[model samples]
Target: MSRVTILVYKGFQVLDATGPAAAFEIAGHFGAPYSIRLASLEGGRVASSSGIAVETVPLAEALQCELLLIPGADNPLRAARQKELLTAIADAARSGRRVASVCSGAFILAAAGLLEGRRAATHWAAVEALKRLHPRTVVDAESIFVEDRGVWTSAGVVAGIDLALALIGRDHGDELARKVAQKMVVYHRRPGTQPQHSALLDMVTPDNRFAPLLAWARARLSEPLSVERLAKEAALSVRQFTRAFTQATGVAPAKAIERLRVEAARAAIEAGADSLEEVARRTGFGNGDRMRRAFVRITGQPPLVARTGARREPGMRG
Candidate 1:
């Protein structure tokens, strides 16, 4: 059995550690042969950022760690400054053990100098800080995870499961990974190459003053969504709505409409839409070619590829 060690520290995100651990544990039930450990610097009960406590073994006695997984914590910038933690991480990587990080755990990897001059990923909220702090490291803000030179980094909390699933695939095979994902009730495991969920979802201002108009537009995606229509919905003139909506949402009215349409189209496709035409028409793309172009621009894949999650057929284009 491969020894898997999850490094935990004070303020660690509960899901960041447990998510990957559960993935491995479930895979083990299918004969994948993984032995898991949760280890902390002090090696006792560690309190998570969420105020839950979990026990850990001492790092020194963890033994022949084949895979080291680090999870992000609240105030991870502060956690990354621990000299002993950085030393242990550097030592493990130096010994050729596989190293990986989940979410802001990339901060620890960066701090340990494992990610220098390599492409890395972190939670979207922490991307700017990671880039600013580790200028030599290339940060892929749009990816769910990244693997470069055997060091893996995943974006955000849930992406940890994807990283772990990918690792399972690497160690065993795609079949085992898919089975493990299904056991975990994750039906579709997104590849690291796929983009993270839309930035449009996060572009809204904190107060969400434009949410009413956005919700209305989402519900009426099949209707023509001109700026004039959106302005009327918001009870403002076109110019006023344009300026205010941009300020409130950081996206133009028309662009936001297309994004909503794309989101609806993607949902329909993934939910087993029978044809591209129906998806396009329902999502307001009006034609498959137009929807295909929008999907390409938004998700780096055509609608058919996104729907089937594979290569496009020769005659699939409409």
Candidate 2:
């Protein structure tokens, strides 16, 4: 069995730790050989930025484990503890254990000297800092995440969730990961090649009451649902709704709709839709031609290849 440890610190981001934890948990349900425990430099409860407290085991207890996960916290100014945390990550990496980080946790790894001369990534805001601090680390600010050697790094917030799903896929299989993602309602399997710079969801803005509107549009993807209809459901003027939607979700309303339609088409095709035209009609793409272009744009592959259930060959790094 693989033992995994998550390193927590003061004022740590809660989602970063919990999202991957949930992934590993679901991964384990598929008979994945993984066991997870939360660890800290010292064993105790650490406070999160959201006021929720998390208890953890000691780092000393996790040293012999197969994987170590480091989560970034809100308090990056805690230089001393950050330094100590970096040293531990470096030590674990040098010892041949798999090491991973969520968001700004890449900074801690860089501080420990493990990221030198290696490709890495972090949250967009911290990408410049990572590059400046570790001159040898090739920082890709737009990647949703990166896997270098045994060390993996994810971009801001929910990208960590994608990294975990990908890792689960790597350890077990794509089918198992797909099951876990379905259960978690993640909807999309944003690959490492996906751009992290684009905002796709509006969960951060509590005031944007667009979930129902989005769901309504999602159901009628096979219809001529236009921006005018979507804005009307939100009860706002077209210009106002478009601006607010873009501000909250990070993508233009039209692009978001196209993404939803493409995702729906892929699901339909995977479920054995009679033909590409049928899949497109069911997904609101109107025709196979549009669906084909959207599929290539979003997934870097044609609809036929995706519908054929072509299994992705894992990249072996020995």
- What are the root-mean-square deviations of the candidates from the true structure over C-alphas? 5.0, 5.5
Candidate 1 Cα outliers beyond 4 Å, as residue runs? 194-199, 216-252, 263-282, 296-318
In order, the Cα lDDT scores of the candidates are: 0.84, 0.77
TM-scores for all predictions? 0.79, 0.71
> What does the lDDT come to for candidate 2?
0.77
| Model 1 worst lDDT window (10 residues) | 309-318
Instruction: Please give me the total number of clashing residue pairs in predicted model 1.
Output: 0
Candidate 1 residues 33-84, lDDT tens each? 8899999887999999989999999987774789999999868877688898
Window of ten residues with lowest summed lDDT in model 2 = 309-318
Positional deviation of residue 184's Cα in model 2 after best superposition, in angstroms: 3.4
